[model samples]
Target: MSEQTAPRTAAGDSTDRPVDRTGGGTGRGSGGTGRGSGGGDVGGPGTVGPEPSTARGEQTRQLILETALRLFRERGYAQTTMRAIAREAGVAVGNAYYYFESKEHLIQGFYRRTHADHVVAAAPALAAETDFAARLRAVLHAGIDVLTPSHAFAATFFKTAAEPTSPLSPFSAQSSEARTEAIRLFEEVLAGSTAKVDPQLRPDLPELLWLGYLGVILYWVHDRSPDQSKTRLLIDGAVPLVDRLVGLSRLRVLRPVTTQVLELIRSLRH
Candidate 1:
C-alpha cells in the first residue's frame, strides 16, 4: 500500500523485469502522469478504406505492443520513438497509434498483461494450499518465478518508475486497475487460509501482504546475486516472520500493540 516502505533507490516498471520508466516515454510502457500520447485519427481523416479483419487487427496490435516493448527495453523508455516502433513492427505509424493511444498506454498494457499472467501462475499453488502462510508464500514466490524471465530488464525501467509522483509508478492512479487486481489475489489467499488472525487484520491482510511484497521487490530489483539467490532467501525467511506475526495477533498480551497498530493504519487514510 505504501511505496514509501521500500527503499527509494530501487524503482522500475516491473513487467516481470526491472526497468526505469521515469517517463514510460516513447517506446511506451507507462506509469501515472504518463498518458498514452493522444493523437489525431490513425490515418488522415478521409484516407481510410477497409479496416484489417478482426483477427488481423489483433495480430497487428500484438505486433505493435511487442515492438514497442522491445524498443523500450532496447533504447530506454525515454529514447524509443513511436515512429521507430511503427517501423520495427512493419505497420504504419497511424496504425500503431490506432492500436495504442501513446507510449504510456503501451506500458499499461504490458503491466496488465503481466499481471494477468501472474494470476495464472499463482492459481495452482494457491488452490492447493489452504494454510495462510503457505498460500501466501506460494503467491509471493509465484510472483518472483513469473518475473525471473524478465530479470535482465528489471532495472532498466525501475529508475523512471520509482518516482513517487510519476504516473508510471505502480502506485499511480494509472495503474489502479492492475494494482487492485494484485491486491485482490492476496485477498483470495487470506480467504482460503485457516490462519486465525485478528478479524480486522483478516480483511486488511491482503494489502499488508502486498506492501510486504513491494518491499521484497525493492530488494529484488537491486539483488545482483546469482539467480537472485538472496531474494529467494528473503522470501523464505520473511514469510515465516509474517506468519508468526499474524499468529501473534490473537494473543491478549499483544492486544494493545495491535490496537495501536490498527489505529495508526486507520489514521493514514484520513
Candidate 2:
C-alpha cells in the first residue's frame, strides 16, 4: 500500500506566528512600546480611538509565540522552557505567565493559532468546490499546507504529544477544543459535499475524516522521502477509496457492515 501525502508547505501564513485575523493588528515586531501605558477600555480615562494596549497585548502574545516556536525548532520542545521563551521575547517571566499559564498553554495557543490559519487556508478551496471527495481532498491538503512550514519542528514536538498523559496529546481533554475545531472543519467539508453518505454515518464522518488527517500527519512526521512525496501520493490514492466507500455507504448490501462499523465507533467514543 502506497502512503498518502498532502500539500507540503507551511500550514498558514509563511510567518512563524500568524496575526490576529479578526483585523485587530497584532503587529509582528518584538518591540512593544509600553509607552501610553495610559489608555484602555471602550472609552477610558486616557483614550479616544481604540487603545494601544490591545495592540500591545496582541504583539506581545505573538512575540512570545514566535520566540517560543523558534526555540522549539532550534532547541527542541522538551528543551525549550517558558522562562527561556520570555527572555527571548523580551517580556518578564510573569508577563509570559499572564499570556500563557504554562508551556502546555503556549502549545495550546499554538494549536489554536495554527488551526485558525488552517481554517483560513481551507476556506477558498471549500467555497470553490462542492464534490464531497474534492472538498475533502482540498481541506486535507490545506491542513498539510499549514503544517508544512513547521515540518522541521513537528517531529520534535510529537515527542511531547505522544505522551498519553501529556495535555498536548490530541486526544487529551486539554486539546479538546482544538480537536473539536478540526473535526468541525471536516463537518463543513461533509455539509458542502454533493456525495451522499448513509445517514447513519453522517454524524460521525467528520470525526472519521479528522482521524484520517491525523493519520496523514502521523505519516508525514515520519516521512523522510524526497520532499515527503509519498505522503502526497497517499492522499491522492486514499481519496478515491474514501470516495468509493462513502458512495457505497448507502448501498443496501452495505447496511449491515455500516451498522457494525457505527457501533464499533460509538463504543470507542466511550
Candidate 3:
C-alpha cells in the first residue's frame, strides 16, 4: 500500500523550536519553531476581542510554546524539561511558569494551536460546499492534512502523549478546557448543517463525534503505513460512518440512549 504523507515543513510563527524525529533540547540558535500549524486538529478559542495588553503578552506566550514544541519534537517529551526549555528560550524558569502553570500546561498549547490551525485549513473546504457530509468529510480530512506532515515523528509524539506523567494527554487535567473547546468546534460543524435532529440533543453530539475522531487520530499516530497509508484509509472510512451516525441521531429510540451517553461523558469529567 502506498504510504500516506502530510505536508512537512518547519512550524514557523510565534514559537521557536526544531523539527526532528528524536526529541531533545537544542541549543539556543539551533532551536526552530514548531510547525505553527502542526500538531492536532483539535479546535480553537472562540471569537473574542484581543486582550488589552499594552505590551506583547501573546507574543511571549507564543515564543514559549514555539520553543517548547521544537524541543519536545527534537528531544523526546520526557527528555525536554521545563528548565531546559526556559534556558533555551532565554526566559527564566519562573517566567515560563508564569505563562504556563506547569510543563503539562505548556504542552496543551500545542494541541490548542494545532486545533486552531485545523479550523483554518478546513474553512475553505467547508465554505465552498453546503452538503453536510461533504463538510464533515472536509473537517475530518483537515485533521489528516494537518497531522500527516509530521507522521515521521508523529509516533514518538503519541508515545509521549500516552504516558500519564507527560503533559500531552488529551484527557489530562491540563487539556480539559482545550479539549472541550475542540469538541465544541466539531459540534459547531454539526450544528451548521441542515441535519434534522432535536436542537437540545445536537449540542452534545460533537463531543461524541470528537471522541470518535480522536480514536482515528490515535490510530494514525501509531500507524506505520509506509507513509501512513493505513491512517488515510481510516480517515476515509471512519468519517462517513460518523456522518451516518449523526444522521441516525434523529431517531426517537436513540434519543434516550444519547442522553444517557452524554451524562456518562459528563460523569467522566468529574
**In TM-score terms, which candidate is top?**
2
TM per model?
0.78, 0.80, 0.68
Off by over 4 Å in 1: 1-53
For candidate 3, write residues 1-270 as lDDT tens digits: 111222321221122222223332222222433211322211121111122142454666787788887776787655666667767776644345445644566657767888888989988876677666677778887887887766665676577678776557787776788888778767767767767765556766777778878888888877777877787788778767776777787788887876787788789867
Q: Give the TM-score of candidate 1.
A: 0.78
lDDT by residue (1-270, candidate 1, tens digit) is 011111222223222111223433222233333222342224321111123345656677778888887777677776666667867887545456556655667778887877788889999978798988899888888888887876776676667678787666888898899889989988898888898998757777788888898888888889999999999999999999999999999998897988888888879857
**Runs with alpha carbons beyond 4 Å of true place in candidate 3:** 1-57, 149-153, 163-167, 198-201, 251-270
lDDT for residue 61 in candidate 1, whole number 0-100 = 78
Compose the digit string of candidate 2's lDDT tens values, residues 85-188.
86687665545554665667778988999999999999998999999889988888888888887889999878778887878899999999999999999999
- lDDT of model 2 at residue 177? 99
What overall lDDT, based on C-alpha atoms, would model 1 receive against the true structure?
0.70
Q: What are the C-alpha RMSDs, in order, of all predicted structures?
A: 9.8, 12.0, 13.3
Candidate 3: TM-score?
A: 0.68
Answer with 1 or 3, whichever has the higher TM-score.
1
